[model samples]
Target: MQSNLSSADAVERIVGFFEHLSAADLVRIGELYSADARFKDPFNEVRGIPAIQGIFRHMFTALEQPRFVVTGRVVQGDQCFLTWDFLFAFRSYHRGVTQTVRGASHLVLDADGRITLHRDYWDAAEELYEKLPVVGGLMRWLKRRANQ
Candidate 1:
């Protein structure tokens, strides 16, 4: 579990990894994250590579044709920001409904080129809650009311 890549290369590798994520890739999580890495998103805040891998594993099980499209990237020193669109078809909940969640990830790589911190920024109401059946209607109504 060693890499001779720079911080920028680490970011590139991460983006490329998610673009074609599969179950087998879970074993290689250590290649991308340090043993004590922290990963946080709107719904989950986890520490360690194993927990991070678990989140991704659940994603593959819950979604169909899931992929990440990196739209933009900015790297400076050991930190980088990546803009992306997560495209997926809902498996059980909204089966067959394709959805896209535009988001960004802020990653910090350690001296070893493994991620130490990974935080994702995205709107849950717009990306998920608003796409549900009953929740969608309520979310829309609440949005209109708030706008009024």
Candidate 2:
């Protein structure tokens, strides 16, 4: 990872970094993001490399076999959009069943090819709450009531 990387190279590196991300790879987070990078997903919002690293660390702690499968990517200059499926099983419950959460990330890369802005978009209610054991029932009921 270099600061002079082209946008295409940067995007490719990001996709590959996520698809093969592991706890061991957490040490290389700075290779993908700038020191002052800002990251925001449905659950958390933080800036800087350490805070972003904490998010990934928490993911590994809270989920079982958490992984990302990138489906598509679009790049325009310094901005890139990636569509991906996040697959994981709950460590607390439903340990045998893997869940998929479809989402997209909007990223802005710095001149050095490191991510300066990372924002993830997804439906927390439909993708997450609807998959929980107890909350799933209530979420489904609410969805059906709203649809009707």
Candidate 3:
């Protein structure tokens, strides 16, 4: 049987687990997630453990030295809100350029202290689209026009 924990302990454990997450961690993801966990981010949405692991696997494949830094967090009841930064260098397209995306996650824990729903919120235009070579130019132009 899975062990249950307090919300605070669960949050702290999760933060520690995510700080060094990698392809190897996928196998142990169930340590923190229920069987039906759902995860969503700016680019992808998936449910279940395998789907969630695939997302991280793609992250490793597409980015060099990608990592997550938990800047802060708040846990209340069965829900936790976490603010974080994703740092990585594009493996091909934007090679050599280090990218950082500031974002937040809303996590819901089940009675067994396993994650049930994890949703990430970030600005694609400012954080991702603006970093691309061509799209960035157009995005900046649009921003300037809107401001003026």
Candidate 4:
């Protein structure tokens, strides 16, 4: 059997996934993930819902009022690419070092309408490393040198 859904519909579903995320809802992550789901990023290569939920929980703790706002999204077949801005404040850092990181995630949906593979592509050096005090200065210097 074949199902037909528009690209806009797929993108809506992807956006809904992030919009409905709540700290307590981490337990229901399995409902959105395939049995053999895989998630990859620069810092993590996690598989399965449990591992993904662990990362989400960590994110909840690490960022104060962390929320993902979808700026744009595109879908083609079973794959959806979403651009988003993450707004959060890290309490561990200085008193007023809140961060807004812009990034994108590519999600592949399974036949059962669950996310099978999720890959996030973003510049860590620019979004994260460059936000730090000392590291930011060093990264900026390195970037200047590389561009020269």
Candidate 5:
């Protein structure tokens, strides 16, 4: 199988991956990630597809409704940079409190046209922590103290 993938093809495949995520399409993930894929984010450092899928499954179960909306994307060679807004209502926490968190993911596709490494960049304090009730108040208090 040919390994090299055009930048456009890579982006399309990635967009598809997010769009069809709720379907739990493991087959699509298999096509997009290498067998030894590594995914890293602020809260997770998961290896392999099973582990990655497990995370998504947990997310699906935890959130009332979770979805990724791609706001922008830039592709160069084997790398694709995507900016997205994640919208979800936390069923476990503030019921009906829907939040939209902006984030970026950098994906590196291997020679086999599969993602070898995926790293997400985002600020938990701004995107998540500040939205919590007690924690948000504490974070605001700390910020005020630091500025003084």
Candidate 6:
């Protein structure tokens, strides 16, 4: 966190960091999050900068060209909301087909402008499992059955 950083500045930095995130940028995770920051998404929940870095590292290993395109944002005091599209290609399955997962993040910044809480909202069944091979068929069938 930078000294005397404002809440808006912190939100901007966080958005940019995620938009251009890479494996090498993992080292800079502390710049955006507090040492004991908590992060939670659909599949995983963890605390601390090191744990956050591990999650991003696994993303790089699991996908090809994974990136986030921020579509919109809203900031209120120390809280921020960001809507984005996560684009990537499966390394083992549909290697060449790009997949997009639309999601939003809720971030709370500390006084020094470091994120203390990061929560991501996305539908894993519709965005992820429905794109897989065998699981995709099952997921689609299940969705149809539920809809009917």
Give the clash total for candidate 3: 0
- Tens digits of per-residue lDDT, candidate 4, 1-148, equal 0346454565576578787678998987887788779999878999999899988899998778788888988777788888889877777776455688898999888765678998988889999888878999999999999999
Which residue pairs show backbone clashes in model 6? none
For residue 25, model 2's alpha carbon misses the true position, in angstroms, by: 0.6
Quote the lDDT for 135 in model 1: 94
Cα displacement (angstroms), candidate 1, residue 72, comes to 0.6
In angstroms, the error of model 3 at 10 is 0.8
TM-score of each: 0.93, 0.96, 0.94, 0.89, 0.89, 0.96
**Residue 132 CA error for candidate 1 (Å)?**
0.2
lDDT of 5 by residue, 46-135 (tens): 999888777778778888778889989998888889999989997767888789889999998887678888999999987888888899
Show model 4 residue runs off by greater than 4 Å. 1-10
lDDT of 1: 0.90
Model 3 bad stretches (over 4 Å): 1-4
lDDT of 3: 0.90
Native-referenced Cα lDDT, model 6: 0.94
Better of 1 and 2 by TM-score: 2
Ranking by lDDT: 2, 6, 3, 1, 5, 4
Candidate 2: lDDT over CA atoms?
Answer: 0.94
Candidate 2 ranges with C-alpha deviation above 4 Å: 1-3
Pairs clashing in candidate 3?
A: none
Clashing pairs in 4: none
